[model samples]
Target: MLRVASVLSFFAGLVAVTIWIATALVEHAVERDASRRSLEWAEFAVWHVPRIDDLAQGLPSDPAELAAFEDLAHFGGVFRFKIFSPDGVLRFVSDDPGSVGSSLGTHNEHAVAVLTSGEAMTFVKDGREKPDRPDLYSETYLPVYDGDRLVAIAETYMDQTTKVAAVRTEYAIVGAALAGMILLALLIPSGSLWVMFRRLRRTNAELEEAQVRAQASDKSKSEFISTVSHELRTPLTSIKGALAMLESGKFAELDGSAKRLLEMALKNAEVLHLLVDDLLDFGKLATGGLEIRPCATDIAGLVQDEVDRIDSYDADRQVECRYTGERGPLFAHADPARIAQVVRNLLSNALKFSPVGGKVFVSVRERCGAIRVEVKDFGCGIPPCDQERIFEKFTQIDSSNTRQHSGAGLGLAISKEIVEAHDGRIGVTSAPGRGSAFYIDLPFCEGAAEAGAVELRNVA
Candidate 1:
């Protein structure tokens, strides 16, 4: 509203200035042309009238000259005409014969100037001062020169009310046209601004509505994941327990082929269990319900344990795991279970992507006040573009139906959440076909071994 008011005020001021300047220029031009025409008429009348020499001696008695002067004064919009002698004596009067031979006084400036300089002068009279002639008149004083000799001055007064009225009519017409143009100029932009304002309002309303819907949808999705994970847990737990019993020699009498089949079943069941667990963790993380239980833990021991576990799981594929870097205990304040989970996920990925007889290197060290663990494999590495997005839930580099990998692709996502919950960061560095290295950095906790007893002495 304030903006609209300001724009209107500005345009109003501009239109007023334009009209004032235009009117002033028009009035000046009209008045100047009128004065010139009045002077021309006065000069013509002076030429036709009795000679200035004759007027200097006495008023002309010629009927033709007197009649000509009378015609001009009466019908040519000329209010009056008079001839003054060089001595400032009024020699002739066209309107009033009785005013002839009168003394206009020696101090008459108009008559004195014309008689002395032999030049013309023109001016307007105030209408209020002439009761008989209420309209304004343009008076011209012209010197009638007798071949370079001073004679007399002829003064003529032309009524200017008609010319002024015509100029005023023209001004009225021009003012109306200019007003219309100014109004149009103001309205066009105003209308466009109003329309734009309306669109902005509508866009904001729609965006707000969409945000509400998106929030609701997100809540519903989290709830669904939480409920489904809970339901699948019961079945998954039973299947794993049954598979463990079978593998624990309860089926020792079974044939070799049957035993191998049972082992494969157990492996696949474990994978499914891990997927269900991942979903539950992701749902908790999404809803801000995930909790981190931090305690003084040996970071090197955790990485070694996870590396050994993954190596054993992939033993059939001839994959090997090697531990390097600082051999001494590197302590950090972290949730042991969550940190172990992150390490296990990285080791699993490295082993899965490695070829037969490939080696996975696990490194643990302390650098820059932080405990750093890295899992590197010389396998077909991730593309640079896909590396960043691989940790997103349900995203995978190989998503085609015929891809070699299994599972729902939530391992890295859950690992990322678990590491961050413990105030740590996890990331990957890789290039296509070169290799991949996944690293985790956690703030080092000094004097951790003295604060807590060693959880596991030998991680191998």
Candidate 2:
């Protein structure tokens, strides 16, 4: 019973706050609209009121002019009017004529500011507190300017009772309708909540079923990868080795026709070998089974070896790969073998994309506490749009030139994963028709600092 009482008290407090906020919002909106109308009325008075500069000078001496002021107070739905001299002394009041020669004390500064700035200030009142006049009124302190000088300020109070009442009643009716709908919903709480909970449970069950099926599908994919790596790759590697031996002319020297066929076989077999390796690497990365063994290793030397090895591969293009570096080694704490794999991938990618007989440039340098390696190729470059998703697995950019080159697109994705595992970063910069430069930045470790640039070039 105590807990139930506490909950009820909390809910009652929330309801009170919500009602107060709603009421305040409605009041503010009504007041804002009233203020705008009041300003318009003040502007009308500024343009139409006729006094011939007599009011600004002092109380009107002309009886006809005084009568015009008196008639204006009762006309145009205006409740009352009070005119003040430039010094804020009350010059005239339509309702109370006797109280006219006094200074406007507290409101004097505000009236002077409004008149001097040539702007009017307006506000709305509910008028509930005043016992004598309990009706809505809009008061505007309208400034009257004569060329450069503030001539006078007029306090115009207009009746806004009907409009204010209509707006408030409309807001109250809508609020009441919304509250009644909420009460009706609360009355059937058990039925509504029971149906809602049933639907929620049904959704939960479907999600659980989907989760189970996804796990099974993932298991099947792993099994397929295992079979390809073990059963297929082993025989494929041996067959490729045999084909390489036959193409080398050391084992069973053949004629041109046979040699050409053997060369083609060996080339396709190498492609198959690369495809299998990429698939295995991707699978390992996906399952988080691929590990990085970090050690203080020479990053420059590592890159140089990969650069030299590029010439050995019989790719589509026989491009010359150049390695540029300083005299000393740029060392970083990284998995040498994994980094080598990344370098190998980038080099192959560069070679594949390069025009026949074009040059591939490989560079290693220390940059801001990181050892950076870059592989650049002067090929029909990748577009800006495709550069974003180039490192994603199975992402082959759509281009006529790119279509000629084939792979599972897992090389760069695997390279990215490898670099990140070593607390490093990898990316590419390319623009169409210029070239592409793929780079990897590994955190610098304690090693021999490097300076001076030397280039090493090897043509395949």
Candidate 3:
């Protein structure tokens, strides 16, 4: 949860920073454009003022020029112009419709600056004194000259405070937006991570409690099994001794029925002994008490020995064992005795499932940086779904009440444990009514590089 929060916060902060920079850059660009346009318009008004003055001076100073000036003044709102003769006499007044003749002097700084310097001037003017007029305006004054002499002055006022104010407002809005974005980026991911951490902490607490309960339950189960096994061993020993004595005729000669009963009793005793041994072995394996001593053992030879043992087990069926591949000693890093035990278990399982005169093939090969051993049998194969579960303790593929084979069902489970202790993997492949192949793959401890080089190009 902390990890997730850190990543999200980093991304959010990055996005916020990017947005802030982009907004600042865009606002700067807008302000630059606005300033450029405003300066261009000011320059245009200043340069064009001379043309207006020339038209007024050349034309006749009669009702025609006066009427024409009046018409231009009314059409151009908020614009006022004053035209004077060379003797400083007012020739035209655009603001007054009736006044045709008037005298003007340098009474205002705006008009004085333009007339004296014969240059354009710009200034801001307040419109409060003129209530019927708009407020907050900028004025551009242009001087009209005939040759080297000043003729008149033209002034134009444009409303522009609103545009300046809009730019200011946009800047303020962007600042506020940047602040809001930063807050959201920090707050949202942090709050979510807080909630996630709370839930995970709760889940971890529950898991700890469950572990405690499982440990206590397991302790109780182990104690109970140990106590029961001790009590059963005493009776089993007595029963075995009495059955052996009767078989030897220590008390009296037994009839056919009596002898048969003794043999049955001995068989059952042996079965009980096997069950106890399997239980003990399972306990040791579970508690990590089982030990293995590994060496470079001839895996093929070990497999053959186990196969020979299987052959000794008398049955009407002939279970043939065959070895394939390079017969030269195929060595593997494993306990010879344990390896043989695992082989014996697989062979026994195969024999039980095979029909009369069925064949069991054992093959050993060094390949893929490991020693591969496979035991295949032409027997009633396990179901596909049951193949994985068959390695589990007490799990039998054939669960019918009248199943032909019987055992404690711990052989394959123990075999798997032993194989894995040597850093190996065991698996089975089977299909119904076809056959089953049980295999073990163990890492080679020595000469692996040589073995691998030789086997690299050997495809199987």
**Candidate 2 ranges with C-alpha deviation above 4 Å:** 1-9, 12-212, 248-250, 399-402, 447-460
Better of 1 and 2 by lDDT: 1
C-alpha lDDT of candidate 1 relative to the true structure: 0.79
- TM-scores of all predicted structures: 0.64, 0.56, 0.58
Error of 1 at 366 (Å): 6.7
Taken over the whole model, the C-alpha lDDT of each candidate is: 0.79, 0.77, 0.69
Q: How many backbone clashes does candidate 1 have?
A: 0
lDDT of 1 by residue, 1-460 (tens): 9999998999899879977987676557545764566556655655666554665556546776667667767545667777677665667777764452335323367878777676667665558676667476677777666556667676777777777678777887888897789889988999999999999999999999999999899889989988999999998899889888988886566679988998899898888888888889889988888888898888998887777677567578898889997765788999898888888888888989988889889999998988999999999999988988998989989999999888688899888888887788989999888789999999989778545445345433
Query: How far out, in Å, is residue 416 in model 3?
Result: 1.1
RMSD of 2: 14.4
**Clashes in predicted model 3:** 0
Pairs clashing within candidate 2: none
Worst 10-residue lDDT window for candidate 3 reads 99-108
CA-RMSD of model 1: 7.5
lDDT measured at residue 199 in model 1 versus the true structure, 0 to 100: 100
Error of 1 at 371 (Å): 6.5
